[model samples]
Target: MDNILMKNEKFLEKQRTYTYTGYNLTIHPHKTPEVYIDFFEFILKEKFFLSTGFRTYHLALHDLNYLDVNNKLTGLYGSLVRYENLLPSQFIDLNTGKTPEDLKLNIASNIKYKPTFFHFIFFPENHKIIFELENERSTISYNVVLQFFKKILDSDKFKVKFTSGEVHTLTSFKRVNSILKNKKLKHIEFLVSRPNPDIFGDLVDETISEYLEDQKAKNMTLTLTAQDGKYLDLNDNTEKLGVAAAENGEVKAVIENSNNRTEEISTKKFPLNHPQIFGKSVTIRNRLLMAAEKLLPKNKISR
Candidate 1:
């Protein structure tokens, strides 16, 4: 961790993640939105968003504007996500002497990792999108998490990882930073030991295909570590989990011989909304998101 991050004691305690929960959204567009990336930049250029209700966020090519797939407003990527009270607050850009708007609302956390959703993914190097989902239970949804990664593969944006001049590395936060900066999925508990002998290869391949679909890539090696069990079916549940991920993607089939087993970790995926439960445990954290967002602009964290 950077010394600056260390100095921010709270950052380390939370593993560089502050709690952000509410009925937020992780918008997955079925069709590209009419407002393209360039257009988004043009609109927000020279402006800033005083964040209103989310905890954390990051940006990709643009400072704070990420264009969702096809540019449509919002859609659930996978079957489900960490469907807790997590939500991201919204804000918009305003001049130094002006105030910004606050946009906070409920958004279902249903995007999950699955096999069937590989149809429209675009994996750009360092830009693989993920679709983790939450369910009725309080626990996180690992199956939905798989669906999230699968959706990223469908986006065809994964190629950005190897687009010449695009230096890549697993060690550097560059790759995953966009997701984090954009508040796509924070509190990601990266596995200490990755399990490479796993069959999630299909998921990775799917991401590669979408990323490299229209254009040629630098043919770079995506430096990924198969964390022993973070995204694996640790309870010898690969076949079952794989089937679930696939089903969530609209693949209405079960694991034919899903007996094959593997070890993976469990991750919780879901969209966040500020003022989302405001449970006793997260009251202080909620205050932080609201206060920081007030400093920034609402609607600034748009993808």
Candidate 2:
């Protein structure tokens, strides 16, 4: 028999351990190894970790070409991979014999199974007005939703009216609520059957501008459900909305026919966890990077 060594002893000895999110990950050939072998070994380790611990590991691919390689690795184990500037791609177990595209479709189907809820909170004095909008038919754009709310806020019909022996409309919310304190009317309800309807189109922009300027009502919380059914607090100053989850599932905003009309766009059930604002489509991937940046420490993240 011939003495044949498949593994390099020096390379194996040089394995380096790195800490990410309190997890210790060991990388083989600490310095640098053949790209194929390095990625293969990394995938194997990730598989082992996931099976035993069931935690997601973040792997940063410095080169764009590695995306193709990562796609290939999906054959070994099917885990969700959120690549840079790419759609949320998936890799599945080899036994399933399913392609990444198939996994994507499966994910899309799962997203459609559940309804999404957008929760908003407005604080007026000691009272907190909570509004939860449900969408079961189609996705609605955040701008359009904001516009809808703006229309309601600016509408005289929805405004606080004093009918006690006199018909008077109060400009200040605080004053109106004070007079109607005993009425216990805090929430205003509206029905939105369509996105960016012609009814509230006029008051959309103006109300958003006024609402943004109002210091008293500035303390508002906006939360949107993610594709995973977990609510992501989008009101974070850094995580402003470009595209977000809607009642039905997730909704995107896009310009229609180069016209000023903005439309709410939804595709089957593909929920965009993080979407960036592009020309007419919300297909860009910068939003995911921004989200990762906010979640991970500054020193731990790389470009």
Candidate 3:
């Protein structure tokens, strides 16, 4: 009995490590109210609980626990539950050593399901979320997360529109810098849409702003490239470039190194917000709070 217990403990220890990815979510209310209702308050008042079904699985949020930072409410730790029904065809009779025949089987008798849990944390203050790729089984994909949120919000009568971007860090930038070191900038492109005023304040040029207003254009694209092997030193505007690349637009640049090797670099290549790993030693609530500590701005962390 002791030997069996020891093997089970070893197996669980090996399965503890998990990777979590982060994303920023901006929520919009249905109407332009004088004061926007904070998400945390809204959830509390509404007693929000997501329960919905998709093609193959039913998804729901379960075992939710809220966290407070410095006496202020901030985020929550929860488990996403996915339930998939088992089909009769998946079963094989031991005596026959063959698959179960559909005609001979009763569909209602085969009403077995498997439930999976993917633990996650969300900080409403910054709208940052960290999702565990897996607990011990399959991964909850990015597309699934997006769709799940959209459906839940829609059911609650909240606006479902959201802008999502992968967080990148300076480490990702260092890799790009190494690849294009001493390279000549050959081409650059920027695609901008209805920029969020709160985040893109004063970043848009006067001329471009005027053009957008006058033309009432939904979006605009700008391109610049060096001619005759000339170097375009656009690095001087890194501040504006970073904002444009991250929030307002997608930025891409092509460069040619001295060895005649050309490579394409984009703002997307920068790894700003990297994934984090957690072992079983960390509790679900602490895992969520720790992720918030790392991603949330210092000033916002407390408040």
Candidate 4:
């Protein structure tokens, strides 16, 4: 694999320089012991989970701007590849009416490896990749999985192209200091869910603060919204938390936290709607949308 990768270094370098308008890549199965380069592409493109199928898997491609709310590109700047497995239960003995424990043992004995969730984020413009794994078994290393996809790219099987004639590469996170000369103010709001919003809000605020400080992003402002609808403004202390009417006519709490007391803050009724909240985590998605909104021009609104 290393030799194959080294042989394609020049080709990979050339491919990385070009901004891709779109991409088409092949995916190999996780259970396969050997890399089956000739596998049908349709198998890789199928949904991760199926009701009647013996195998379950998911495959999707998302825009960078959509995944990373802070990104300001309309073109395809990055891609996220997520793959997970659904348990194999077809081998279970249904006719014999085995007990749950028996079935469990049977399934365990039949299974060769533990299932894992693999997430790969590729920033083609910067030639950067972020890989994450969840519930991974000790039997498999992340590099082994990564190598499978890397091999596909190294083989020149995965192809990409730039849509625009003029190409500009954004500052890569790996080399932020050399590329990012201009300092831009970023306002980010985080909404915490119920079951002790105050504590969670504080933790989120501290996390954002530490992140900004570590990244040397001094121009950013962090805001926290609790489950009760009250917001804590980390920037200007004068702002107060207020009550606002949501689109559904329900009352929602708005910003204002000062000196660890809520009484000193003033209240107001404002109707605001944000349509870009996404992701599985409510807290994270709201934060991303709020951060993106803050980066927008003052005159522009999400609603």
Candidate 5:
């Protein structure tokens, strides 16, 4: 009994009970924790909440039920087709060029139809669905999925287009802002995957303009193997981005990852971007080049 107890009498005197009101809880984002703004609705509902989302650590909160003391919680995980009713229409109407008033551009339109990597954070008290989308670039799909939220939710605010077909600013921006801040938590994966093909290329365009604007954005480099008709006009876009970056002392030189098959780099400038050519994937143009009777110098300047 030498391992016995020495008790402080003060420890026996008090018991504290913690109450988790709908207001008391919040949907903590995966990465950025500093942002803890409460949404208009309470997330804790008595019944089960529903979702069809990419699994992540933050999502555990829903299944676990706010780390309950009694060890009981509720959630509903359904198939992609199952949640059609939950999804908003006009959500993926970017290509249509015609967006409905109630429906925001859908996130699904990007990168073809793949498994969606998003979640719906439920606020039980307010009966609101805090749709949390992960903004990522580590993979092609990550960026594409984020397109949904990015297009609809502006920085720390919901850029809601009104019902009367007229855009209004009646709602308090701050309340919505908190929701955005919490949603934009840390990058889910180690690095955001580059979007595929069309989507991937667009990201290169966005990266220079958005995140790297403040740096010495000189001599930026782009790497990709483009087929003859792949419509690679990044040179023009990069030049524009470079100039803007320069105004802020960023992005000087540019290099394309063309990697050698046919397209050649033609440029000479310190703050220059040279498209480094890479061999393109197997394509009709590539087959013809392979079948050529006489070898044409790649520097033939076809374009």
Candidate 6:
């Protein structure tokens, strides 16, 4: 055999993580369809400049493209940029070892700026919108973005309120409690695993502990129902245990009440994210649009 030496090497590719938070947007009832279209069109060309103390910030929309074919428009895609005009006080002379104050800098003009970006896709037919923030390194938050949106709508004299709420990662217990708050819980079904002496601390009752040791059961399915709208009052410890299991995704629960409504509590944090390769061929906008396309359902739009 020839002396052929092959060396194995490990390579790590640079990847960007993208997190898109889902939202439901409802146009104000008073605003007509024409008015809504006009408002969005106006914002496409508008640049919002706001100042906080000495720092001036800019918010603007860019890359306004429509998913239209043969004069039928269905969706819109764009990016929101939030940047800050760096004040003279933020600069320092590296070679001269002098700060802005030492150099007697009194001008209000700024020459440098830092920016944060958020990409969004909107379906006008269904009022479904998705937003992906820049990166985790950016200090800007969704609340700040929401404020800018509201400010622009107000400044543009859009009368109707634009309300947006996120679809969050919520626990089943939280959802159940929220929907049935102050209402009678008529039925409930949940699964509980056999108690582990090492894990269940005070949660495992004396009877359950003995039962687990003797029977060696793996799990149990409990279904409780009240008669004629009566409430099933669960003990505090049992409820706590169920809730803990639900948070961990170990419990499957179904509860029905007279006051049950289709709703979920929204949060600002995006709990889901995906990693992708960042390279020359794939731009940030392209990556965002690609991610947004996967979230749309075929029959989501009514028309």
Best by lDDT: 3
RMSD of each: 19.7, 25.2, 8.5, 21.0, 24.2, 17.2
Q: Runs in model 3 with CA error above 4 Å? A: 1-15, 28-60, 69-73, 85-112, 136-138, 147-183, 193-219, 235-238, 247-249, 257-259, 265-279, 295-303
Highest TM-score against the true fold, candidate = 3
Q: Decide which is better by lDDT, 5 or 6.
A: 6
Better of 1 and 3 by lDDT: 3
Model 5 regions more than 4 Å off: 1-82, 86-144, 155-303
Model 6 residue-pair collision total: 0
lDDT of each: 0.26, 0.24, 0.53, 0.27, 0.24, 0.48
Q: How well is each residue in 1-303 modelled by candidate 5, as lDDT tens digits?
A: 333332443334343211110101112111221122122111222221233244321111222122132421221211111122224442455776654557743454222222333333322221212222221211112222223223323322332221110011111122222211222221111111111111113434346433433453322443333354443333444433322222222221212333523322111112111111212333322222232211111111111
lDDT of 4 by residue, 190-250 (tens): 2211111111233333453355446644323225343443333333221111000011011
Q: State each candidate's clash count.
A: 104, 4, 6, 9, 58, 0
Worst 10 residues of 4 by lDDT: 240-249
Q: After best superposition, candidate 2 residue 50: deviation in angstroms?
A: 7.9
Candidate 3 C-alpha lDDT tens digits along 109-201: 224357788886765434456777555577666556656665545552444322221222112333334423334778777765444233323
Write down the TM-score of every candidate.
0.19, 0.16, 0.58, 0.22, 0.19, 0.47
Poorest lDDT segment (10 consecutive residues) of candidate 1: 162-171
How well is each residue in 1-303 modelled by candidate 2, as lDDT tens digits? 122343443334432211111100111112222332343343334331111111232212112122135453211111122121223343556776664554443243113222233322211111111222222222333323333323333434323321111011101222212212212222211111111111122343234324433543321333232343222222222111111112111222222223534333332122112222222222113222232233222111011
Write the candidate numbers in order of decreasing lDDT. 3, 6, 4, 1, 5, 2
Q: What is the lDDT of residue 45 in candidate 1?
A: 51
**Two-way lDDT contest, 2 vs 3, winner:** 3
Off by over 4 Å in 2: 1-24, 33-37, 40-284, 299-303
Q: Give the per-residue Cα lDDT of candidate 6 at 143.
A: 49
Q: Which digits, one per residue and each the tens of the lDDT, describe model 1 over residues 205-280?
A: 3443344433443232211223443331222232222222221221111111234442222212222312222223
Q: Which stretches of candidate 4 lie over 4 Å from their true place?
A: 1-89, 97-122, 134-141, 154-303
